[model samples]
Target: MSHFNDFNNPQVAALPGHLKQFIVDQHYEHYTPIDHAVWRYVMRQNYSYLKDVAYYPYIPGLTKAGLTIERIPDLQEMNNALAKIGWGAVTVDGFIPPAAFMEYQAYRVLVIAADIRQLKHIEYTPAPDIIHESAGHAPIIADKDYHEYLSYFGSIGAKAMFSAQDFELYEAIRALSILKEMPDADEEEIKKADELVTYRQENMGEPSEMALLSRLHWWTVEYGLIGTLDQPKIYGAGLLSSIGESSSCMNPEVEKLWYTIDALKYSYDITKPQPQLFVTPTFQNLINVLEEFANTMSFRRGGAYGLTKAVESKNTCTAVYSSGLQVSGTITEFKVDKHDNPYFIKTTGPTILAVDNKLLKGHGKDHHKDGFSSPVGKLKNADLPLEDLSADQLKDLGIIVGVQAKLDFESGVTVNGTVKNILSSTEKIQLITFTNCTVTDKKGHILFDPSWGGYDMAVGEKIVSVFCGAADKEAFEEIVYKSKTETHHADYDWKTRELHKLYQQVRNCRLKQGDYGFLGNVWQKLQHDHHDDWLCALEILEMLEHEHIEPALTAEIRQFLGQKATDEPELKKLISDGFYLIAHPVEQNLVF
Candidate 1:
């Protein structure tokens, strides 16, 4: 039996089996003290800088979202806080498929990646880590209109039809993200993974529904700005979480465009900073753009075009007939009529017939183990569409059970057999089973032979809708998008573990644990053994300067950091930022 821990969150518990498959244990104990330190540094910096520029009051929003500047958030704590707002959170291993991610959002559950970025990449990491997921995404959701926009986008995104190439691209990106985040990852391997991502992205022909929707999401949810283009404030999670980009995005070089359907025309590279951003006047405008785009998706516009998209997906999808019957399978081929309407569709492998997203009794994949095929258009001589016909209407056409019938369709397809069963749901004809049946098309090419056993023909005036995944995913046993690549968890070396201990010591000292003397000892160890470390010493200096206890020790630590900053150009800004935040405390912008 598979076990899933929902962390006692109602929204998480309500998730379907297929979606639950993606949920993993948060294992809050696995977070090292150093990891907490990294979280603290990012949160502190974000609060310091984002207070003026962030869309919402950054510090107060963090509290509302169950976060703090002192530590990495515990998942249960986050869930409890989010529950008040009718939301929940869960941890995933790493990058999940975009479709699955969107579905989680639709369920009002945040999928957080529990890992924190390495200390070396403290400023910004391409990987999706705790800082990016919880700090960047969870806090901003406190805004009602913004959260509503997110949930709305999720609902639309969950139904978007994704192509096979889209899956390939997602996998490539996942692999690349995981590799880049791994501290010991090889440069050559990273290069190869990046190339694969580029290859998949470039090769994906005419973007699928999911691809286009992802573009909109990237612009509005991940890297969007709010207010006027000239004086916009940061709202996007990507900007909120990345201390490096949040400051740089304000530069005039990062082109800002008015958010609209036009944003879909722009693609994004996740590995680098966004070259451009979209600005929305209000959060409701974001939903307007999403609604406008959702109208164009295959799920909303069902026909030959929709079926063609489903077939191209090469994944399990469902096509809904006008009769309200649903056929779920991997659509392999679809034949169009002279007017370009789909007349017949075929699934090559296991198929299930459903109505209103419930599987039909005795018509599951077990019964139709091979495939299913049927004509879609109206009969040549029928007064009404097949589904609209009543019992009397069907008997007039000789389509009743236990009757021999030869049915001809307007598209020149014929079904010749003995009608064994006629299935109807909610007064609409849905399925017709035939024994010893032979089906043929206009050119006399046999569609189905008697040797293939009973033929179950789906009844519909036409295929009215087609969308991604099974109509009833649990019933279909569809596990959509399980990635093979796993995130690399670092096994800390003894020396690294010692460094974490020193950081932990300082954290304890800052909590007023009467361990002020430990600072001098920790500073001595850093100078003698860990010459390159700067953040730990910086924290120590902050404590000393605050208390004014050891002027000589404070001056010495400050001199060390200044020298280190000058020696390492990359560490210069981080050291200075630490200095600046200490001197210039950001006022607590908290909301009640």
Candidate 2:
């Protein structure tokens, strides 16, 4: 029998190497016959119901994505089908962090859970499974407009960081998802997980931006309706994937409301079918409402609200203090001290005295015997409303809002210039700069929106690089790192060396090929070593089939064939994973 713990650890260990942390392998062989049977059962049943009641795009999208009611779909293979439409699928181990999930979508990559629900949870699994992720979510990406909206939503959603309390809510839900999927979890563990979930629900105050966005996703992407209230069609992934939900959601008993931004008012329970749903008249309306709501978020609207959110989201940010020093970090907290002092916030990564309260000046020094202080008055820097300041006034304080900004592509320099027209889009900030243009050829033309390059920014804030000619996004990151109160060091060379060693090990495997011993050794690393090397092993195995080698080397390699070895299914399957990749390479595109 399949165990819940197995589901919790369903990620195919070797796939998502360092750069592609969002991906994993499906480990197709791990699925039991029962798993495939359940998939077929659900697909066959749901297809009939969906064809009649589902949204027009649902069926066509599914077909375009090459999904069929046969067996459980391989995410890599699905990516192949999705490739024609400029999208790709990647497998994940159950649920990942919400922000991470959004980031993947921003890159046009679909994150699908690798595990299939057990027979017992066929109707609905509180935990995400292959059926929910691949079947429910993947098909919709086939629609170009819908795909754009989904990714745009992800870009905005990624910006909504959580408060410490709200982050706890996120962690609690993550814990619950894992615990509920742990087959051997004792009664005590279950009790603890249940308490956390309950606590999060009971204590949650006015929904944070992250929470509200989640509610919107649940209503629309997960269980939404489209068309008129009287003649609604099933479009939500939750409804399309579930035979039970698909049929029940459209029944007269369920309350259907026209989808609006106000839908954020209602909270949802993932454990049961939603009692009410919001229906949209058209897909374009979804994008409009989403973009409008996103603008109201703290990241888009600079000031205390924007800074506070950036801190909670743990996004690296640059801020100027009254004393003129700038600092950036993976911000951990944004709160007033007990003294009701709101002059300074706290950071965890590289501790520095941010604001000196006694002197009332921002200090960039690493040492802080008397704790951090602010360079500017608390009210002036963060407490003041954003609307109170003009573009030039904010610019004087080193704050760049929507204005004609000078961008130095060569030096990565950006500064406030003159005010120009502002443009709007679902994914990013768009604006035209005039008068003081450095790019002579494109003067009076629109500067590129940084969001197109995945640069996280405040609502009205335009990026002005301090460095000259550093047009790439790396230049922007370098500016933040350089401005930090202390250097944040990472040992890149050492990490690269270790990865190179793993590649050498894969190369060394060719010498021990007797009875597939070389393959088994690769299997061991795939199971035990770090993920970065997993891809190297797969690539090595994929290449070994045709590479000519000494016959003597082959004979010597066979010596270990008679050695007894334990048969671990996962390891055994991993040894052969290369063949699958050869057939279906994960193809991803940069959708800026």
Q: Rate the local accuracy (lDDT) of all candidates.
A: 0.88, 0.54
Show pairs that collide, candidate 1: none
RMSD of each: 1.7, 18.3
Which whole-number lDDT from 0 to 100 does residue 496 have in model 2? 49
- Per-residue CA lDDT of candidate 1, range 469-564, in tens? 888888888887688788888898988888988998999888755768779999998888888888888888988887778899999989989998
lDDT of 2 by residue, 133-209 (tens): 87788777777777888888877775564544655665666666666665555789778877878888878776677
Q: Candidate 2 at residue 366, lDDT?
A: 33
Candidate 2 positional error at 245, Å: 1.3
